[model samples]
Target: MKWKTASTLALLSAVSLIGSACSGGSGSGSGDSEEVKDASAKESKDPVELVFYSMSRDSEASFNERYGDAIRKKFPNYTIKYIQRAQGSDLPDLINAGTRIDIHWDSIGSFPSSNMVYELSYDMSDLIKKHKVDLSRFEPSLIDAMKQLGNGAIYGLPVYNERMALFYNKDLFDKLNVPYPQDGMTWTELDELAKKLNVEKDGVLYTGFSPSVNHLFLTNQYSLPLLDKSAMRPTITNEKWKQVLELQLLQPTQNPVYQKAMQANKGKILDLNQFAKDQSLAMFISSPLMPLVMKEELSKFNWDLVSEPTMPDAPGVGPQSYPGYFAITKMAKDKDAAMEVIKYLTSDEYQMECAKKGIMTSLKSEEIQKALGQESAFKGKNFGAFFYNKFPAIADKTVEESQVPILATYTKNLNKLSAGEMDINTMMRTADEEASKLLDGLKKK
Candidate 1:
């Protein structure tokens, strides 16, 4: 089938901002089962049950409905179950206790390679090569990142991908007679657009803009890992860090809309509520899942999305893509069956179904993106907006591992900076000193 290049690029861009992992780097099923069946008969036997491990109930349910059901229907011998928990919680106990976990599926960064997670190249390599499952279909950066997790071994395959974008209220834009946000807009442009939308009507305040600084600078888009992994120290004091901090600091924190909501609620964080429910927020930066979060209020106001604003220096690059990955374990009773399941999950038919449900697929196919959100209640909305920006490449392994710790420390200091307790310079310096000390201690231990 001839797929449009435009659609593929759009999905790639959207996936980047939606937390689907991607970097500036560069699927199938059926009679294929025979190849694997011949290679290994253990997985072909009946009464096989597969465990889907994850931290989100929604992801678990989605996987069951979209992937698991399809897998069962395709291979009647298998049963799929879920094991959900907090990502931080210890799971070695369950795995070591002889629990039959064939597939380890969870969001990006949720499952780090450790004693519990199995390395895939040795066990699944033969299957991958035999099936001719094209790993090149994925971007080089993504494969590189996954391989880095296990010393250049394949540990998992991405099931779905996501990225962030600017979602806006069309009603608010019309109500204020301001032009809506456009694609390819820079942060400076967005700030100006937000300024125009910041106003009041009928005593209800409308916030022009309220993108979280932590999200834009410290977490998602335009964020780099703040630790120097080789040196075991924080790079929080870098000028780029200061630039990010200053960019947000220069903006208005509480637009009239947010302030009004806060006053009405009294000491509560109503920013998200304002954006999603109250319809007071003009624009917010978030994932395409925003539609799902605001399903109850679907028709309350007309909304649309645009690519997240980009940094001037980093034109076109939005954020790193973060998505859930599915890996087969070496300890599975039916390694062949697990490989088959992985193949099915990343297949075009299955991934297209995912797109129809408003979920993002990591498969780099325009046909998949064209099918995305087609059957969703959000159908006819600006799904293309999700793909407006380019995805940034994930950094090296050391930086990737230290992201959480560095972000954690910077988050605290960011709070102080926002609250006026510390100046930008002071905040950056303090975050650097404290994070360096913290990482140094961790390295020693």
Candidate 2:
């Protein structure tokens, strides 16, 4: 995909001169070799536009403000292009239109469905070695997840990470005279706390806790596999899966107060909005992006975070790492330059900046973790909760796992379970059967 641009022409000339000088020609001095190396480095940073594509639907202006500006400042010669999904520039659309995407970015869970499915993933192992990129600098789980997704090949570098945390409304807890949630609390203890805070006050039914079910399932601490790849079937009816459902969903909704609240709200899940805006939720288990996403509403309330509640079996282990990665695509016009850009994005300097902005860093650096949210308006908040717990190992997602719409089936059964129409065992069995049917349909297709 290389273009015959002026920089390429100059690079070719530099290579020829360096080869001539190395062959015992005139001007074969060490100084000449150093000059040639410097010239090559400069040419590598020459003016080349890279188009970034993601299904995130972030606006160009937002991307520029968050990352594009820093990238441009770092490599002034390079042009940055962001293809917004909102502009109908999806991977399929770009491919059909012959658009050359240099980089593809998305959460690790999405790579199988998006980049790999479209055959846009480019193995960056050779480039990673060539650039001397230190994979050890990042959280091992993030790197391990990338390799797992690529079947032992490095296809991407993690730029940032997110994880589930227990965000509690300080005001609601104070009103109920309940002590705050402490880090390392087990799910059983958290459930008791939720029960304490689930009372009605001043005509408003304040719920104790609500987890983002999708996030919980995606980052299940049990490292449960949704699909049994060998048999190419859903694995939702396993004992571990049953335990997760009992702990996360059925047991929580079994509370009469929570169930009444759900019925009152017309079966709507008590989500982030209830915690941030309505102020009726006492605690929420969600991503650390909450403060950034609900800046204004969150500013009006008194909230703090603790480590995500753990299972009794997995004491200190939190959810799996949910990281966003930047990968060089197969369609990149200049793979070397693309590699350099992604490497910079994962470097200590940029990662620290991201942390200061309240974005979780993918790096394992203690200094970076300490600096998190320092530059943000909520600097005084409990940023430590983001890294307080150990991340569980990531489970490998199979091809069938990505192809089957099993999560939808789970969500449907969860609704039934929430309304007390089905028991936990029945819900699991129904979800498994439905998911298997969906998988069968896909196989037939």
TM-score of each: 0.81, 0.89
Give the C-alpha miss distance for residue 202 in model 1, angstroms: 3.8
Best by TM-score: 2
For all predictions, the C-alpha RMSD in Å is 7.3, 10.9
Q: Write the per-residue lDDT of candidate 2 for residues 1-445, one digit (tens) a residue.
A: 1212212112211111111110111111112245543543575567889888876666676667666776676667889898878555777888999999999887776678888888898999998876667787889999998888888988788887877788899998988899999998888888888888778768888889876777656788988767776787777777887777777776667787788888887886677667877898898876656666556778998989988888999888888877878889988999988877777677777777677877778889999898887877688888888788887788777666776677777767677777788787888888889998998898889
Give the per-residue lDDT digits (tens) of candidate 1, residues 1-445: 1112212222222332232111110024422455554543444456777776543333455445545556666666778787655444335656556665667665445446332233322335577776556787664556665666556667677777777777888988998999999988887888878878767678877777765544644334554655664675677777776666555444544355545544565534334567767788788776666565446665678988888777778888776666667777776666767777777666666676667777766766777776667887779877876666766665444423433465566766554455455688887777788777776676566
lDDT (C-alpha) at residue 338 in model 1: 77
Candidate 1 ranges beyond 4 A from true positions: 1-27, 30-47, 57-63, 86-90, 113-126, 217-223, 252-270, 397-405
lDDT of 2 at 60: 74
Kindly provide the TM-score of model 1 when superposed on the true structure, using C-alpha atoms.
Answer: 0.81
Give the lDDT of residue 150 in candidate 1: 59
Clashes of each: 16, 0
